[model samples]
Target: MDQSCDRTRNSLSQSPTPPLVGVETGPASEFTGKYMVLLRDGEMKEGLQAIKRVASLTSVCVAADYEGAAVRMDEAGKAEVFVLDKLGVAVVSADPPQLRRLQSAAAEGGAILAVEPERIMYAIEPARDRLAILDYLRGYRDAVNRLYDSLTGVPGEAEKELAALTAFTDNAEFTWGVQATRVNQSRFSGRGVRVAVLDTGFDLDHPDFVGRPVVSHSFVHVQTIEDVHDHGTHCIGTALGAQQLAGGVRRYGCAFGGDIYVGKVLSNQGSGADSAILAGINWAITNSCRVISMSLGARVQPGGAFSSIYENVAQRALTSNPGALIIAAAGNDSNRPIVIAPVSRPANCPSILAVAALDSNLGIARFSNGGINPNGGGVDVAGQGVSVFSSVPDSFPAWDQPGGPGRPWPPRYHTISGTSMATPHVAGIAAMWLEARGAGTTAQGLWQLLTGSAVRLLLPSRDVGAGLVQGPV
Candidate 1:
């Protein structure tokens, strides 16, 4: 017998195929000729052997080296194989007959868990119109400053303290979501909690995070851990930035003392493959992180079910890590009063908490995704997202752009909108709750406590779920 044949036999003999859950059997319409096969955790070797076996049965060409891994390709580039061992998943492009055979092999081999179509994931933020938004915010800030100056009469240390407090409270950094959740009153600071933020990576040398404990990795092979795009850094800042900036100008973060785990799942372009996101989740679970924050997702049609791979991974992480919770953005694809988009993928997974975005007035953000599914996956909570301020990379050009004609340019501290901003607020708040609740609490229990404590609003459940997520009370 050939060596490859021997390996295939060994792989099939290892274990029996597990039941497929939440996975569609046939090829998806979006992925008519391609599918992704996910293996059980730590079973990459067996999975690869199974894949090779399936390829040998078809007319596919199996190449030993395709970007540091093996690939199976058919002519016309319509069929290809991407073996993502780090994610325990393999992406295969094949015709209907080939896909069915692969699925059959996967089911019999046991090493393959799910065979679903590949999906795209992206950072959940609106296209940057920050320059215009910054100008409007600057005007508002000037007005507030003028009011503050007019109100100050007594000149003393007490007056200065009051001034500082006013400035802090008035800024976008001190968003209404922060005030509404009452995080300021909580004594807990997520001191020992480890939070994994899976996004477009972070600025490793950001001055604000100088002394903080940060561990970072890059799943996007082309990019390093350094964040060229500011999305990841902004989200991390909201979740784990310092309590105060250098001059005590603002109070922007929630879990000030939480350990930061930055996973660059998305590339600098702010888009990523499903395999990369899954790999990031695996990394977070392996690292024993208490909270995994994903401000990224792929839009799915209404009534679409969650991905089995992500759902299973989230369930495992919850059971394995003490109080480990995965929080994700609901996405920024809605146009209220017109079109209302459903919660995005991964976030739509029941095991993951889906967070919506709310403005200062407590209304749902125009772009915040809704709970259209009505079954399992829906918006679980709300957070401040509109005109929200947080830390950004000092080198980001948007920060230096002049606000309109005469208005001052936005500072290193930045403000933006989207469910991307809201997600970290919830992640940081979850960290605070985890800290207050102490140990032995399960992820589901923390989720209940967080949702149960939410300040109910008048918005529909489809829009805000249990309402604004609260901090430790």
Candidate 2:
């Protein structure tokens, strides 16, 4: 949803096909030949030892070779061979026969609970032509600025005129989604709630969020927590930006008082593997975040089942303290006028809440993916996505002129359209509901509250699910 399509497009085209359930394959199968073994809670040390023993017998180097291995501390704060102890999962490279032997040993020793093949996942592409629209807006703003500057010879007059124009744009009414969902009328501000947004990353220096408490972590090894790609910043802003900008104008944020947790699952190029996303989820769960919002995913073919590993992880997170509810974008692969795409991976997982995109007119966005899969694998709700206005990094590169100084006119907000944009609206609304429900609320209860409270719109169940998500009264 970052408007950068090169990497994502290639990923989509070359993505590996998922294996069928209970299907037997040879060592030369297209599968990655790598398996993620999930250890039982409180059995990480035993699991590691068992894995090391298997490696020794098989003559394969342990993934956790202390000298030059991929070393990272575990959740227990101990420097371990694998980096996913908190999630109780370990990545091991092995062929079918080797994996079976490892599984047998793990089961016999009570080291691992389950084993699953590591699958490839790509970031969902956003609505097309968004960058062009942004550029047009920037040009219009520059024109307005030049005209204002040329007309006003006196400093005081120029200042007064600029203030008036800023006020006009700032004092605009609530966004259509906010008004349609009646979030503007909600008294609850999601105070004392921690919401984790797993995406590209965030703009550490964005002025609009300057003093807001944000706990951040980077799961993508190549990238830091700094959001060079604007997708994560835009999603985070909609979820937890300040009610008022630095200039005391524009009331855009929904959960103004909610605690923010930024997890960089995707790399700076707006692409990442499933391992990084799984790690981000583990981190969010470890932090006890009440709601985890994911605005990225990979497209799924019709009849494709959800990822069992993600579903299991989400179920575990739901049973954690205060419970963590995952809300994800349904994807932007649909063409309402022609073909309708099914819900994507991660979101297609039944335990996760899949959100679709709605326009200002209460119509389903043409690019919003549909709920083609039956049972629990469709969209659960809708949110505002088209022409959505939210915060972006002050120094975002896309906003800069081709040959001009690095800085284009400084901007605190941007407009984008995608199910990715729609996801945070639901996330923020969920936070408000949590705040109103007070303590001792579970993830399933929050999901019910959200769907039951949604306003029924005149759209297909496949397109809009339970309808548009609403805020607490």
Candidate 3:
């Protein structure tokens, strides 16, 4: 078998030959985006070669090497192509010069995509077969006094076993500080900021977000925003939900009045495929969702994954939308020496703001992912993640009973815990910063403020990241 296709043997196969590109549902008239049938890996080079045979297609460009790939990944003027690793998530190693340089530059700005070549197959395929394997591994995430054999697709649990995690218990003590840090000057409501929740769909009727117009798109099968799931809705509510029940007193989130974009990239199963994820990301970029909260990730992926796509998208969002934000959950299944892995593509994205989880005391969540070590590893900032409260679909298992197997049912809202819950906090803060700036800020500028305003904390013995995520200064 070709090493490229060796990534995973998927259990799900699309019929109708899976169009190379086009809307997954309904008529092609809904979208005008040109569609390209990206042949599976090994076929990419040949596919491009075949395209060269057609002289009728005048508008065409070809790239040869990694440099050419980096250059043509869209010329900073067209759509971006972010690739997930064969492992199904972001790349973890840093042996390749390109990836190393890209990760190194991440702390400074949001640009550069792709990483490591020897350790990672740069022209690799997105692995979806392994998602099911990884999501199942999370089942044993909380078992104490057990040494878990690292699975092929799941993450490490050393962090979770090592410590207890938490988040704000009430809103009172945190709100004043939230206001003081990023918006001590702004007195008006945060009515206009746009937050994109690119996880599972959100609870459209949750009281906290009742009137927040939810414009959403689904890449997962025929599912829509009306679908219910714990992870996606949880992250959505945290960022811009009017008020939360944490640390007491009714607390308005960092962006209490921001509008929302619910991008349902993942499915009701709490897991998703890399291709679907990439499509969702492209949609977010094209739609101009300024602050997107992605509380989902793949457990495994090659190092420096998706450089071309992320670089292009980040460039567009920064240049066009300015002040735009991408916040992602670090991962749960912590408390150990091994940190949980990141989602495909974004995990290694320079422009993305990766978030871990914290307990009420501001200690890193045992299950949250941390920063990369000097030798080459992941590094991430922590946020509150324990017993997080958020909206759930009407049919959420914890809140709703199954009428029958395979029966039609609507979704509802509920509470759950994971780094997914922590991500929205930082996203909300970014929106507040954007609102306060009044003028569009640079990606580097927004990152500086976010890191600067974050409250410092110690964890993982190496002091992995800056500290607790807070409003921008």
Candidate 4:
């Protein structure tokens, strides 16, 4: 065989299909090159005797009481096919999370074999070799493998920045039944809510956020999927950052933790036009994101009315099934030549919620958008925006750099001010609201309920809309 062919064959030799390990398309045996049975019966001797009767093999390694070895082997790039005892109580009633971890580890390596509960005897008893090869090839690079995964990015590769969560004990002053967590703690801890914030980007490596699994994508011509503008992650930290990180604490950030999706719609300059936001909105909807928070906006809408991409997409995005709630920043530019786009454009559209900024003291942010909406319903609600602390990417202008001209690595975190900061708090609260309404609530309902439930701050109803948000009541 040629060099390339030889390399391809070698990659497959490492799989763990056990003849019928993956998605069941056909009979198991026409697959597995070899297989083993992890007996479920109580009598170890009887299980071994069964294995002996079933095979011509001489040696055997006992399956861990918890499948730890199988999991570890797969993680370490060894052990192809495995027969998990279907009869053992512990094995049958295995912990779902541990099992999922094992599965994940296997997928990472491209080799893993798991027998159906007590049915190892059934799935593999007939044929094992083909299954083994399948498991091996799943992790290995072979001609048969073809998928949407990025072929350019190496598997298990590391990113430019590693997020670290610094935990702190809450000083009584920092406590106040925060909008998102208070509700989440009382009710929905975002159990399974998949919140995709299409703003900046997330600190994919942060400890509090590690569990949710961040899927990042960049839309602007200048940025890549690893976009770390810090806008998106800060928004994310407010919505789903884990509280009380084990053995430590983070003063502010993270809404008690849940799944977070990062759809970067803005450019590194932190400015995004309609097209990018539209692409991000469409992608989030296509990905079935329940709540999408957009804290970034542009100043010039010189294009015709529908020409404003953010508004157009917001209107069209509302038309999808189950739909998605699009939350936007009401701009920090105070009333002026064109203070900010009226809610009607983006927030004013069908299902959008245009949010203004509020300070921790619960008042309109001094620099927030205002004046009056010549045509309209109330403006929108407010959330904690002033003096907020959040993640800053290595490239954010807020940070000072060293080595690479202006760009730096291993960034130092900083806090900045903007309605951009306040918008996320509202977005996070909206997500918690979605969780409270249960599975029946759609993205549209989330926006309406949020608008309706707002506490109506002192500002003119048009300035603050329904008012300030209160924890889910």
Candidate 5:
């Protein structure tokens, strides 16, 4: 396998240069004024030189010179070009005429591969009312557990005794999500695999993950890997939480044995830009992580085209040796029985896996986006999302408090819904499959096993591409 950045060096060698479309602009297309530039593999120096010449760029900032990919964007923003060396990509701030010059260079088969406007993205926010339904489900579940305990044994002892019987049942020992995916029955624990979760930073002090191996870095300018927002902590909990949990907390994660990689691409306010996301992807690939789970994306219009730069990067990741499979959330923009939105960006790229959300009854989530558009915008798989139980920062407020209680414990756990919650389930299960399939499996091979082995549902393929993803037996 070629180790150089020019994984697609042959893209221009044997063919005529494709017609250039330059940068797109309009009211519907929301982008930062800056542009993203893809450099041909192995021609980074030439690309930089071309950019300097075409755009008359005077200042440049290269990521290779920084520590932990923490390039000071404040300083970088002042430069005419900011280069992500590992990914062979750059963010350029230039005038429209200068951008046209770069496009002309690309059309002439120069080192510049592609140019597009940088996009704005966010951590997929669940529908405003989705959490209300999740809260109701949690209440019903607790009532059932309380009734079952009172009718059978001591108030709390039922959970401990029946924990052994939780393999296929949703109870106090295992979340409905764990039972739905059947991860509880799988023997593989994802040992020796590397799983990267890119979102808001994580709660490094969370007690549930006290002893786990974690490598964390932040691409968000000036932000550390510490998850100030609860979203990243919750997502990581579902993908890599401990199996042998203390305090009788139900099992929520899959791939408990996989090495954890945390990439903080989104900010504490649950928003981010394309440059941060691309940098995070580069860092994950550089580390050879086998699974890169992103629960963030920008909303796309019904017929919006996917980013060519992202598509190319994802393809290279799949083809590279010791490659990584990137999974992302389908947007939660639908109203169900009313309106259905297209899948979100980045995930809409053909090479990335788009994940939809499923409720406890194995029904498509009302807010889960679908395949309303063509060209790789379909939802590839479904996972448990409604009323999901997962870890959160200890200081985080519980989603539900007891009705007439004296005072419940400061629950270090939470239950929520969204495609954001669903994506990690697919990612964690992918890690388990990699462990089960053996060291010889490529990223493409893992993708095949995932969709091929999915439990087909009656839902339209648009809503659930191959149906729900399942753990390997």
Candidate 6:
């Protein structure tokens, strides 16, 4: 390691104060008053010394000090610098003078790659009227199914079969998403592969996952890996739920045999800092999880730039030995036929697969974002998102069910709509592809396998990307 703090000290004596790395553009956006420092590959120790020398920081917490990048959050919260050792990135709390000095070190080109402010991210599902939208889309699907049945001849059994094949809907055996995506027909079960879902955590006590293999940890401060918000449970169910559920209702999951690594990055309130997310990713990559599903993001403006810190991390994760592919939600910030918001941050990064949502009709979801932004901000794939059926925590309260619309009673299973719901479908299918393509498959290979085999829709590439992701035959 470059233990020459004296060199940095000498350079600082002659050089002028450098500008801050990043500025907050919006008043509404929340920052943690900390900055993310991306270190050059294989220079982690050197980078730490440079940062500490430049910033005059005292306390530092390295993930290696703990087990499996699982730094004690309480201790980490008190440190001036917290390093995700495996990821080669640091979350730094610095004063103005210290920040300027650190920027100078980065400019001088020694170990430090880049520096940016850490922003808070949330579960990509919108907070308002989600159930109402699901109800409306369900009604729309039912109407379309009824119309198709009425148009078919009432005499022949073959005509009924054709109608069933053409107009897909949630049946007694499988979810509409599973049927539409052809997951029910795929021979691959994603066996032996590991899938990581980073979100609001998961329900360990959920009966559907009783015998399933699950490895879980929490990165959020003062929180457990247990899911209280219901988002993580839903996403995990879509990705790794069993082929046959406990209640023996509809089968909703795609990868029934893959290992589930649950990282509680977001809090029970459905929000988390960038540092926690990065830590979660580090944990996943360190554990060699082949497919990482992140159904969470921070919304960006029309021309917002993707985070270089996250981009570098994802790119390295893809190209590293036994690499992993990262999949994230494209966001639910748009109103179709009108305003179309750009893809969300982190997901907007080129190295991360950005997934958009599609309804049962194979049309883009009304709230699914588009690839309107420049650079790497584009939707890479589409997945079944609207009115998608999946599992939730058993403790989840019952909503408008029984006499009401199609919501499940007892609340063990629930149907919702978002790009959040769509991401895990793509992730679980990626697991299947990894298993089908062979054990030697890399992240780049998996990416090619997915985009190359996608079903091209009639919509523009910006909206549907390569189109709906398909499973291996």
TM-score of 4: 0.55
What does candidate 2's lDDT look like per residue over 1-473, in tens digits?
33344311101112111110000111121234467777767777777777667643322323234222222223212212243665667666566666787778766747766777765454434323433244335435644774667576656566544432321112365666667667778998899999999888999888888888888877676457898767889889888877777745456678988999998877776776566677677777767789999987766677877876677777767666667899998887766657787887778888899999876556677678888877456888998877676777765543444223422223556556678888899999999999999867899889999999997775688899898898997
Clash count, candidate 2? 0
lDDT of 3 by residue, 1-473 (tens): 01222222222222101001000111111211222222223344433333233212223333222221222222211322223221111212222443344444433332222222211111112223233234324433533223332222235554543333222343433432243233333453345777777776777766666656777766566576665544566566667766443223344355777778776766665445444554555556555566767765533332424444444445445545363566665444333446444333344355666666554445554455544423233544556654444444555442233333321222343223456666677787777777777546665577777777776554552333667666534
Q: 159-230 in candidate 4: lDDT tens per residue?
A: 311111111222422332253224433544555666777765566666555566776666555456554545
Backbone clashes for every candidate come to 0, 0, 53, 40, 1, 0
Q: What is the TM-score of each candidate against the true structure?
A: 0.75, 0.76, 0.58, 0.55, 0.83, 0.87
lDDT per residue as tens, model 5, 303-347 = 888888888788888887757899998877776758898888888
Superposition error at 413 for model 1 (Å): 1.4
Q: Indicate the residue-level lDDT of 177 in model 5.
A: 81
What TM-score does model 6 achieve against the real structure?
Answer: 0.87
Better of 4 and 5 by lDDT: 5
Q: Alpha carbon lDDT of residue 242, candidate 3?
A: 65
* Candidate 4 runs further than 4 Å off: 1-185, 246-251, 300-312, 335-345, 348-350, 376-378, 394-413
Candidate 3 has what TM-score? 0.58
Q: What is the lDDT of residue 6 in candidate 5?
A: 14
Superposed model 1: Cα runs more than 4 Å off? 1-34, 40-49, 55-98, 106-111, 124-173, 321-323, 399-410
lDDT of 1 at 178: 66
Residue pairs with colliding backbones in model 1 are: none
The pairs that clash in candidate 2 are none
Reference-based lDDT, residue 390, model 4:
50
Question: What lDDT does candidate 4 reach at residue 183?
Answer: 44
Order of the predicted models by lDDT, top scorer first: 6, 5, 2, 1, 3, 4
Please say which candidate is ahead in lDDT: 2 or 4. Answer: 2
**Ten residues in sequence with the least summed lDDT for candidate 5:** 1-10
